[model samples]
Every structure is written in structure tokens, then in C-alpha cells.
Target: MKQVEVTLNVNGKDTTLTIPPRMTLVDCLRDELRLTGTHVGCEHGICGACSVFLDDEPIRSCLMFAVQAAGHRITTVEGLLNEDGSLSDLQDSFWECHAMQCGYCTPGMLVASESLLAENPDPSEDDIREAISGNLCRCTGYQQIVEAVQMTAKRRREGAANG
Candidate 1:
């Protein structure tokens, strides 16, 4: 297979690389771009472990081709950092709430939570549950993850009101 060139805007940086047409976006981001934050789980879309933001929408990178992602913006788990390199509010909430155990599902959970918060900053418990339903977590029984997202929502609302 001939390798093709593709450019992806990831984490606010433009990265150009040559990859096989069959390469998945997750592989491109991990193998070529050295952004290993996006983990590969089932390799099938069933496991959202390889989730990332494609143009600000959460998608399964393992199911997306590198060529298909050309000229699009991507945000891996690594991109969810504060400007000062500190953990973002969502990540902080996860930590404060003890949302992760083995942490395999954390990246996907974080992406899902972020997507929900982006669309609905003030989400109900049911809404949070629905948003994270796609991302499976074998640890913490999802209660901590829900609590983390709720905590993040509350903090974001409080911060917005204060500012």
C-alpha cells in the first residue's frame, strides 16, 4: 500500500505526516505524532478507549481513518489540559472524586464527560448517565465518574457566576 500524506490540526498544532491509507486516526496520533494519550482498547468501536475530539465532537478514533481526518481538528486526551499545563476542571474533578481505578477507561470517560459539558454545562444526573453510557468503565462502578462530572458542572457554574 502506498503511503499518503495528511495534515491534522491536533491540540492547536498542525502536524503533517505520511501514513498508509488504511491507518486509523488513533494510530496516526499515537505512532506518528507521539500523542499516546489516546489508548487502543477493543480496536473495534465498541470500546471508546480511543475516543478523541474531531472538530470538537467526540468520536472513536479507532474507527476513523487517518486520511478521513485530514484538514480536521483533533483533540486527544493530552489536549484536555489547562493552558498552564495543569489538569483541566474536568480532570481535576475526576481526581477529586476518585473516578478512576485501573484507569483504562478514563480517557474515554473524560472525553465523553467533556462532550456532555460542552453541549450542556448544567446537566442532570440522568443526563450525565446517558452521556457516559457509551464509555464503559470496569472500575469505580460509574458512581465516581458521575460524581466527577457533576462536580465539574457545579464548579463550572459557580465559576461562571463568580466571573
Candidate 2:
């Protein structure tokens, strides 16, 4: 097997690693960088469990090769935190709303929800549903997830208005 060096800007940090060309982005993030918040589910792109942000856009890490991610920004689930190391508003809302049951899909859910909220701060229920439709969750019946996103949006709006 041949090894290639690639630098990935993840979580606002740049990390260079020597890896095989065929290694998936998720594997590189977890195995090499040790950022385990991004889970590996189906290995296929359909599960959405391996979702992450590629240049602030939601993408399936499992479907991309590590070498292919070179020179691009990758934000894993662990990156979606406050600079003070506290949970982000969306994460806190997920916890408050009990949006996760098994936790396997929470990371992807957070990524999807965060991306949606970034584009549409005050998303309606239908908008929320459409945004998160790509990620599947067996627990919480998705209602809590939707509510969590709604809570985060409302809080952000209130914070902006109060300022």
C-alpha cells in the first residue's frame, strides 16, 4: 500500500497525516486524528451517521477519501462546540429536548440541524423536517429533534433582539 500525506483543516486546526489513498475521511478523522465524535454507521452515505461539515457544508465523511479532503475545512461533531469548550446552543437544546435516545445519530443530527439553522435562523416546522430528512433517527421519533432545533433558533433570535 502507498502512503500519502494530507493536511486537513479540522475544527479550526490543521493536521497533517500520512495515510493510504483509499482511507475514508471518517477513518482518518477517528483513527488518525482521534476525533471520535463522528460516528461510523453504515459506512455508506445513506446512513448520514458519518456526517460532517466540509467547508461549513454538510457532507458524508464516510463517502469521501481522506486525500480528497486535502486543503478543505472539515468540522466534525467535536468541532461544533463553543470556544469556551461549552456545548453550543444547538447541542444544549438537544440535551434539553431529549432529542437523542441511543446517541448514535446525535452527531449527524446536530450537523444537519446546525447547517439548517445557519442558513435559516427561523426555520418553520416543515423547513426543519426538510433539513433533517437526510438523517434518520430511530429514537425520539424525530419530534424532540425538531423541537430542539426550534428551541435553538428561538433562543438565537431572542438573544439578537435583546442585544
Candidate 3:
């Protein structure tokens, strides 16, 4: 296989790498970029563990070729962190609400939840459920995840109102 040079804008930084055309975006991010936050569970896109933001929209990185991601902005789970290197509100909420167990699905859950919150500042429980439906978690039973999103939304709204 011939290697191709691809420039991907990830976590607001542009990086160029020479990689095989068939390499999946998840593999590229983990292996080349050393962004191991995006976990590889099902590799087949069904697990949603490899979710990341492609141009600010949630996508399964496992389903996308590295070459295909060229010229697109990618935000891995690490991108959701605060600029000061602290946890974002959503991440904090996940921790406070105990939304994860074993932690395999956390990256995808955070990406999906953050994407949902970005679009809908105040989402109902059903809306959160619908938004995260694609990601599966065997532990935590999902109630805690929903609570985490709700907690983040309420905090953000409150902060906005106070500020």
C-alpha cells in the first residue's frame, strides 16, 4: 500500500503525517498523533467508542479513513478539556454524577453528550437519551450519564445567567 500525506486539524492544531491510505482515523489519531483518548472497542463503528468530532459534528472515527479526514477539523475527547487543562464542565459532571464504570465508553459518551449540549443547551431527559442512543455502556445503566449531561447543562445555564 502506498502511504499518503494527510494534514488533519485536530484539537485546533494542524498536523501533517505520512500514513497508509487505508488507515482508519481512529488508528491515526492514536498511533500517529498519540491521542489515545479515543478508544477502539468495536473497530466496526457499532461500539461508538471511537467517536470524535469531525468539523464539530460527532462521527465514528473507526469508519473514516485517515486520508478522508484531510482538510477536516477533528476534535478528540481530549479537545473537550478546558484551556487551563482542567476538566470541562461536562467532564466534571460525569465524574460527579458517577456516569462511568470500567471507563471504556466514556470518551464517546462525552463527545456525544458535549455535541448534544452544544446544540441544545437545555435538553430534556429524552433528548439526552436520544442523543446518546448510539453509544452503548454496559455499566452505569445510563441514568448517571443522563444526569451528568443534565448537571452540565444546568451549571452552564446558571453560570450564564449569573455572569
Candidate 4:
């Protein structure tokens, strides 16, 4: 198969690479771009482990082709941090709420929660639950994850009101 030249703007960096047409975005991120934070649990897209933001919306990278993502902005878990290397509010909430175990699902959950909060900053518990429905977690029983999102939302609201 002939490799195609593609451009990917990942985490605010524009990268150029040659990739086969069949290459999935997950493989491109992990193998080519070295953004291994995006894991491949089920390459068939059933698992949300490969979730990332495509144009600010959460999408399963495993289901998309590298070529399909050209000219678009992509944000992975690695992008969800402050310039000083501090975790974002959603990430901090995860740690404060103890929302991860084995940590395999944290990336997806974080990205999902980030998307949810971006659209609905004052999300109700039910909204949080519905937003994270696609991501699966084998630990924390989901209570902690939900709590983390809620807490982050509350903090965001507080900050907004005070500012």
C-alpha cells in the first residue's frame, strides 16, 4: 500500500507524516506521534479508551482514519493540562474524587467530562451520567467519576460567578 502524506494538528502542534490509508487515528497518535496517552482497548471502537477530541468533540480514534483527520484540530489527554504541567480542573477533580483505578479509563473519562462541561458547565448529576455513558470504567464503580465531574462543574460555576 502506498503511504499518503497527512497533516495532523495534535495538541496545538502541527505534525506532518506519511501514513498508509488504512492506518487508524489511534495508531497514528500512539505509534507515529508518540501520544500514547490515547490507549487502544477495543480497536473496533466499542471501548472508549481511544477517545479524543476531534474539533472539540469527543470521538473514538480507533474508528477514524488518519487521513480523515487531516486539517482538523485534535486534543488528547496530554492536551488537558496547564502550561506549567498542572492538571486541568477536570483532571484535578478526578484525583480529588479518586475517580480512577488501574487508570486505563481515566483519559477517556477526562476527555468526556471536559466535553460535557464545555457545553454544560452546570450539568446535573443526570447530565453528567448521560455524557459519560460511552466511556466505561472497571473501577471506582462510576460513583467517583460522576462525583468528580460534579465537583469540577461546581468549581467552574463558582469561578464563573466570582469572576
CA lDDT scores, all candidates in order: 0.92, 0.93, 0.94, 0.92
lDDT of 3 by residue, 1-163 (tens): 7998889999999998999999999999999999999999899989889999999999999999999998889999999999999999999999999999889999999999999999999999999999999998978459999999999999999999999
- Backbone clashes, each candidate: 0, 0, 0, 0
lDDT of 1 by residue, 43-131 (tens): 88987889999999999999999999988889989999999999999999999999999999999999999999999989999999999
Put down candidate 4 lDDT per residue, 31-141, tens digits, no spaces.
999999988897897768889999999999999999999999999999999889899888999999899888998899899889999999888889998988988886645
Q: Could you give me the TM-score of model 2 versus the true structure?
A: 0.97
Lowest summed lDDT window (length 10), candidate 2: 132-141
Clashing pairs in 2: none
Off by over 4 Å in 2: none
lDDT of 2: 0.93
Q: What residue pairs are clashing in model 1?
A: none
TM values, all candidates: 0.97, 0.97, 0.97, 0.96
Give the poorly placed runs of model 4, Cα more than 4 Å off.
Answer: none
